[model samples]
Target: MSMIEFKLNGKPVAFDGNPLKRLLDVIRDDFGITGTKEGCGEGECGACSVLKDGKLVTSCIIPVGAVGGCEIITIEGLRDTPQGKCLVESFAEGGAVQCGFCIPGMVMAAEALLMNNPHPTEADIRLAISGNICRCTGYDLIVESILLASKKGEGLW
Candidate 1:
């Protein structure tokens, strides 16, 4: 076991555990942050997506040791921010969410995209969420929701 330290959400966290442990497990099992789900452990599905140093990554395939000194943001963390709230509201308003399993990852992806480009085009929205697979709601509503959020741009930086 090794001591791993990193910033989670907005707080500094340190813990001693197997350095090779999957980040998804550490976030959910150890930290009790279940917002990051495990859909495909191989990183194909974006359900376990999170922001590592402001970049979207699959937590399932990333070892805890690799994230030391990096800033990680899970869906729970995103929900607390204004941009996250806007995405949530826009997703709901545009009926982009269904079954709810994929929304968290989708939201994180959208958040990352908007943070980088607040006024993304339709193609950009599609490209941004391309990694996230939503079996419930089709891509149309999701894209529309992102467009709506882009128009709002209240919380996005």
Candidate 2:
């Protein structure tokens, strides 16, 4: 066992456990950040997505040790930020959320995209969130939501 150190939601944290432990489990069970859900154990589903050093990744398949010295941002951490507020509000206003199970991951994907590319085209938005699968609104609403957020939440990204 080793003490894996990383920044979580802008805060430094250490996890002393098996290095192979899933980051998703650590975030949810150890760190108590349940906003990052687990739709599938595999990485195909984006429900367990989080921002690792500004890149979107599937936490469920990521080893906690892999994030050592990196910054991991979960939905809970982003919820209070301006970017998060913008995306959430945009998703809501654009009817992006339905069952809400995948909304958190979708928002994380959007955040990652917006932070990297503030003015993303529809194709860019679609590519950014390609890993995420939403059974609720298909994907038009979500795409529209991201586009709207890019316009409405300008300068925040």
Candidate 3:
């Protein structure tokens, strides 16, 4: 076992476990942050998405040892920010959520895209969330919700 330290949702966190344990497991089992779901347990599904140092990553494929000294942001972390709130409200207003299995990762992907490109086009929105898959909402509402959130400008940052 190794002691890995990192920042989670703006707070410092430490985990003592196998260095190679999947980050998804560490976040969910060790840290008790259940918002980062495990879908495929592989990189194919975006259900395990998280932000490591402001970059979107699939926690399921990432090793806990690789995240030391990094800033990891899970869905719970996003809920604590204005941008997160905007995304959630936009998703609800646009009716982009259903079943909710994919919403958390979708939200994080949207947040990363908006933070980098405040004025993204429809194509940009689609491309940003391409890694995330939703079985509900037909993606139209999800696209619309991202567009709506993008329209909110800096307030989301």
Per-residue lDDT tens digits for candidate 2, residues 1-157, read 9999999999999999999999999999998989999999899889999999999999999999999999999998998999999999999999999899999999999999999899999999999999999998889999999999999998998
Best by lDDT: 2
Please say which candidate is ahead in lDDT: 1 or 2: 2
Give a tens-digit lDDT track for model 1, residues 9-109: 98999869999999999999999999899998999879999999999999999999999999999989988788888889999999998899999999999
Runs in model 2 lying further than 4 Å from the true structure: none
| Per-prediction TM-score to the true structure, in the order listed | 0.97, 0.97, 0.97
Clashing pairs in 2: none
Candidate 3 residues lying further than 4 Å off, grouped into runs, are: 153-155
Error of 2 at 82 (Å): 0.6
lDDT of candidates 1 onward, in order: 0.91, 0.94, 0.91
After best superposition, candidate 2 residue 135: deviation in angstroms?
Answer: 0.8
Ranking by lDDT: 2, 3, 1
Task: Give lDDT for model 1.
Answer: 0.91
What is the Cα-based lDDT of residue 99 in candidate 2? 94
Worst 10 residues of 1 by lDDT: 148-157
